[model samples]
Target: MSKKGKEKEEETMTFKLETAPFDPRFPNTNQTKYCYQSYIDFHRCRRIRGEKYEPCNYFKKVFTSMCPNAWVEKWNDQIENGTFPGRI
Candidate 1:
């Protein structure tokens, strides 16, 4: 594909949180499965130095202290793999 075409495709891509009735089978480890919008909000806040630092609080609460090392591992895996099952 042409570079222009690829750029257009990337621009058109919409990253949205997939929503449905919460799956009891879903592992809470997948940050993408929970309130995904919330995740995005938190992530952005941290990146932009937004006034609200608490946006990513859920991430810290659930992933950081709860399973600290695992969170880093998951992030590394996502970086290597391009996309994870839940988190974009």
Candidate 2:
């Protein structure tokens, strides 16, 4: 196959986007707490299990999909600055 053909094939390939699955603990319509919790859980899991642990990716995916980009950015900044409100 030609380079252009392979590139076109890659571009045309479909990738599905998914949101976090439902959790009974956060059954309410509002998912604010769910998002926040996932964020904290992700960091906590990383701290406890180390960065290479695969399960921690789940929490990261959940928060990234559910939380607003701006909120995630702010929280990331807070974490970097050691001012994140949640205990992680």
Candidate 3:
């Protein structure tokens, strides 16, 4: 019973998502980002802070606060290639 009020607050970041431009190939309108937005935002903020932080295991969860598709894609690709540990 005492544990209920003692839950910890985890720090998190927000990502702003951009709608995909109209493309003739895909007529159906849709909201899409090259990479997960949450990853970009959290990673950027964490890196800027520059200190030991609890590592986030999940990096592919999409959020509406991502920076930009291009930016996120660049980092995501690099991570997949093993250029970096992982995205935020």
Candidate 4:
């Protein structure tokens, strides 16, 4: 449990994020693609900016706008566990 707790706070700087508007281009109205892409972008941003979360703030808004808190939390866990399906 203690180990898990520390992992929860773990941070990595190995990705990038795009400031341009996110566009999935699919006809589906659901924001799944947008959220996933945002996830990727967020990490990309972190990679460039380092472990500090401030530099990746914009991507946070992009994902939070299209995805629910629960989904984001779950995906974040997947990312730390090396199970995220998206490229980062």
Candidate 1's displacement at residue 15, Å, is: 40
TM-score per candidate, chains pooled: 0.30, 0.85, 0.27, 0.59
Pairs clashing in candidate 3? 15-65, 15-66, 16-65, 16-66, 39-88
Candidate 3 lands at a TM-score of 0.27
lDDT of 2 at 64: 95
Worst 10 residues of 2 by lDDT: 79-88
What does the lDDT come to for candidate 3? 0.48
Model 2 residue 25 distance off true place after TM-score fit, in angstroms? 0.4
Candidates in order have lDDT scores of: 0.55, 0.96, 0.48, 0.77
lDDT of 2: 0.96
- Best of the two (1, 2) by TM-score: 2
Candidate 4 lDDT score at position 13: 37
Query: C-alpha displacement of 60 in model 2, angstroms?
Result: 0.5
- Model 3, position 61: C-alpha lDDT score: 39
lDDT of 1: 0.55
Over the stretch 6-81, how does candidate 3's per-residue lDDT look in tens digits?
Answer: 4432223446655433435434434343234446555665667544544432322333232456766776688778
Give the winner by TM-score: 3 or 4.
Answer: 4
What is the C-alpha lDDT profile of model 1 across 1-88, one tens digit per residue? 9999999999999796533344465557564534444344455566676546775565444434333476557765875787754443
